[model samples]
Target: MTIKPLIILPDPVLRQASKPIERVDGELKRLADDMLETMYDAPGIGLAAIQIGVPRRMLVIDVAREGEDKQPQVFINPEILKSSEERSVYEEGCLSIPDYYAEVERPAVVTLRYLDRDGKEQIVDADGLLATCLQHEIDHLNGVLFIDHISRLKREMVIKKFTKAAKSKAI
Candidate 1:
């Protein structure tokens, strides 16, 4: 598996909604493997397909803390089936957004339906960081970002910063 180049913030590709996988085949499996490798190499807990310039409905996550045996998970065409009324706030970061992080409020518990690596259907009930991570990644599938959860003023500021950073890199 190879580490794919990340599609960073302000990249228009990231804002495009991802298309669902019509069929989960060997090619898609290879993509999931590559995504896991990329996420681990980036030292991030989760990554979405669109974040890597793949406009497909998929994500890889491994919330295991440092030094633990990596527990990589793949979610394809994931959809939220249920969400709890209880709310929790977590400081969320994205691989695409680099070092920027902000407190985002999301449901504390979630039930989701997704296809596993083998293309088998699976439903999961998650809480804590896992729930937040799932919700965040799913947002990417819908052309949304963690910054969008923040106030408009703050969101605009973050975008402005990234826009400037992107400009400098192009120089």
Candidate 2:
């Protein structure tokens, strides 16, 4: 699988909502494989399709701790069905946003429905890192970013910084 280049922040494409996958086929499987490879190479725990310039409802995640066996998971057309009233906060980072990280609050437990890699339907209740990761990636499918959950001032500052960085690279 090829490691695809990430679409960084300030790229307008990241703001576009992804379309749901109509069917799961070999090509889609290949794309998922590539996404996993890319996420692993990025050394990140999760990645969304939009982050790689693919406007599809898909994401790959691996929340395994360092040195533990990799447990790569693919979610196609994932939808969160339920979220706990209890909230939790985690320091979240995105591959598209590079080194920036912030603590974000979200539901501590979530139940989601998704299609697995083999075109089979799966419903799972997730907590801890898995719940947070799923929420973050699903947000991407809806054209949302982790920064959107932060304060307005901080979000604007991050966007402005990335905008400037992109400008310098273009010169």
Candidate 3:
């Protein structure tokens, strides 16, 4: 698997909704492997296909702590089946957003269903960091960023900062 270049913020591609994976074929599986490689290299817990400019409803997550064996999870066309009324807050940073982070509140628990690596359907109940990560990545699939959950002022500030940084780098 190859490590793909992550698409940063202000890239119009990141705002486009991803298409669902029609089948988990060899190419899709390779993409998933590449995503896992990218996520680990980013030192992040989760990553969505859109972050790599794929624009497909796919994500890879590995919540394992340092020193532990990697437990990679692939979600193909995932959908949240249930979400808790109670909320939990987590400081979320996106691969697309780079260094910026914002505290976003979401359901404390969630149940999601999706196709696994083998193309078999599976459902998993998640909470804590996993729940937050799943929600955040899934949001990317829908063209939503974690900053959208924060105050408008903060969101604009982040966008402006990234936009400026990107411009400077382009010089």
Local error of candidate 2 at residue 96 (angstroms):
0.7
Instruction: Give each prediction's root-mean-square deviation over alpha carbons.
Output: 0.8, 0.5, 0.8
Candidate 3 regions with alpha-carbon error over 4 angstroms: none
Q: Each model's TM-score?
A: 0.98, 0.99, 0.98
lDDT per residue (tens digit) for residues 1-171 in model 1: 899999998999988999998888999989999999999888799999999999999999998987789898999999999999999999999999999999999999999999999889999999999999999999999999999999999999999999999999999
lDDT of each: 0.94, 0.97, 0.94
Model 3 is weakest, by summed lDDT over 10 consecutive residues, at 94-103
- After TM-score superposition, the amount by which residue 61's alpha carbon in candidate 1 deviates from its true location, in angstroms, is 0.5
Error of 1 at 104 (Å): 0.4
**Clashing residue pairs in candidate 3 (N, C-alpha, C atoms within 3 angstroms):** none
Ranking by lDDT: 2, 1, 3
- RMSD of candidate 3 to the truth, in angstroms, is 0.8
Question: Per-residue lDDT tens digits of candidate 3, residues 64-116?
Answer: 98899999999999999999999999989988998898889999999999999
Candidate with the greatest lDDT versus the true structure:
2
**Model 2 over residues 80-134: C-alpha lDDT tens digits?**
9999999999999999999999999999999999999999999999999999999
